[model samples]
Target: MELIFLGTGAGIPSPERNVTAVALALNEERGTFWLFDCGEATQHQIMRSPLKLSRLEYIFITHLHGDHIYGLPGLLSSRSYHGGTTPLTIFGPAGLARFIETSLQVSGSHLDYELRIEELQEGVIFEDEQFTISCARLEHRIDSYGYRIVEHDLPGRLDRDRLIADGILPGPIYQQIKLSKEPIAYEGRLLDPKRYVGPDIPGRKLAILGDTRPAPNALQLAQTVDVLVHEATFAEAEAELARRYYHTTTRQAAEIAAQAGAGELILTHFSSRYNREDLAWLIQEASRYHKPVYAAYDGYQHPIPRK
Candidate 1:
């Protein structure tokens, strides 16, 4: 899995960075990508990147803030225009459904596929065979949330050498032996997967937080995650201003990542006041609290490695 930052600015667009938008590409695992916080001109950003609107399967809105959701309607409309026939699901806080419905109605825009809007609650909102997603409320000006995505543990690889030693040459039956829940009878003997398969591979965990001050739920959502994506809207010197505006500072975000034991820390949603030269300072500030800290910019991509 990989994370692509479409925009990384805070409240408004700047010359160096745009508003908040992130794409989680799961091409290897699911053959589709999920979007988080589609800010203004998000579609334009996607057009510039390798992401495809037709392959966008899900959207998770952090809050109803204009900077977080202004590009949602335009992107949705353009998906239809581009002939996106696959169903799409959007998860967000309350009032999101109303906003999207009204936007489509007012613009007389129609979708070419099924669109499902789910108003999020502070708990597990989605669970399939491969993943389980949960959300927790965050401390922001308006109701906001942080999401935790946990991929299911993968089955272990087959013990090819052991199978070969047992006269089972490489063939389609090797797959059957590995995938069978019960023992399979072969050559008057039972072939148990437990005896042939290696230990199960651990899955990866990821946390993506919305705009907020340092909140306990943020720690809960990010606990021991492989990657923790959090907003560092201000520098460490602006701690007071950050607290007043319910935004996190670089040091604060890194501290949270350290406390949560995240493998890596990715900081985004930078204030417009900071230019390209200031980003190095922000990274240095965050690195004091957590090692492997990264300051995200427009079009930045971070690939999450398997445990």
Candidate 2:
């Protein structure tokens, strides 16, 4: 899996950074991509990147803030014109449906594919064979949320030596033994699948938070995650202003990542006042507390490390 940052600025678009939009590309895992936020001009950002709209299968809105969701209607409408006929699902807070519906209806936009909008609360929102998504409330100006995307543990590789020693050759029966849950009778002996299987490979976990102050749920959502994407809307000097605006500072975001024991931290949702040149200070401040901290910019692509 890979993370592609479309826009990383907060509140408004700047020349260096646009707004808040992230794409978790799962092309190798599931042949689809999941978007975290769709800020204004998000589609335009996608055009400038290697991301494909047709591969977008899900959109998770962190809140109803205009900067976090203004481009939803346009992206959804344009998906039809592209090669996006497959079903798409969106998860967000309450009133998200009204916003999308009103925007589409007012502009006479129609989609040719199935669209599902699920209002999120503080709980497990989605789960499938591959992934599980959960949300927790955050302390923001509005009802913002942080999402935890946990990938399911994949089955371990088959032990060919064990199979060969047990008189099992590399044939159709090997595939059956690997997939079957019950014991298989091979040469008058019951071969247990568990005995020949190796350990399960742990999956990667990612936590993406919206605009918020440091809260208990933030740590809960990001506990020991592979990547923690948190908002750092202000520098260390602007702690008072950040708290007053119900946002997080660089130090506060770094503390969250350090406390949660996240593998890596990517600080995003920067204030427009700070330009690209100011990112080194933010990254340095965060790195003091957390190793491998990154201040995200538009079109930044990060490859998730496989442990």
In candidate 1, where is summed lDDT lowest over 10 consecutive residues?
A: 172-181
Q: 1-307, model 2: which lDDT tens digit per residue?
A: 9999999999989778898999999978999899999999999998898888888999999999999999999999989887899999999999999999888899999899999999987899999999999999999999999999999887667899988997788888787777777898887889888877776779999999999999999999999999999999999889999999999999999999999999889999999889989999889988888888998899899998656
The TM-scores of all predictions, comma-separated, are 0.96, 0.96
Model 2 lDDT, residue 84, Cα: 91
Q: What's the C-alpha lDDT at position 292 in model 2?
A: 87
lDDT of 1 by residue, 1-307 (tens): 9999999999999999989999999999999999999999999999998898999999999999999999998999999887789999999999999999999999999899999999998999999988999999999999999999999988788999999998888988888877777898888888898889877788999999999999999999999999999999999999999999999999999999999999899999999999988889999999999989998999999998786
Model 1 pairs whose backbones collide: none
Model 2 is weakest, by summed lDDT over 10 consecutive residues, at 172-181
- RMSD to truth, every model: 1.3, 1.3
lDDT of 2: 0.92
Error of 1 at 155 (Å): 1.3
Local lDDT at 134 for model 1? 99
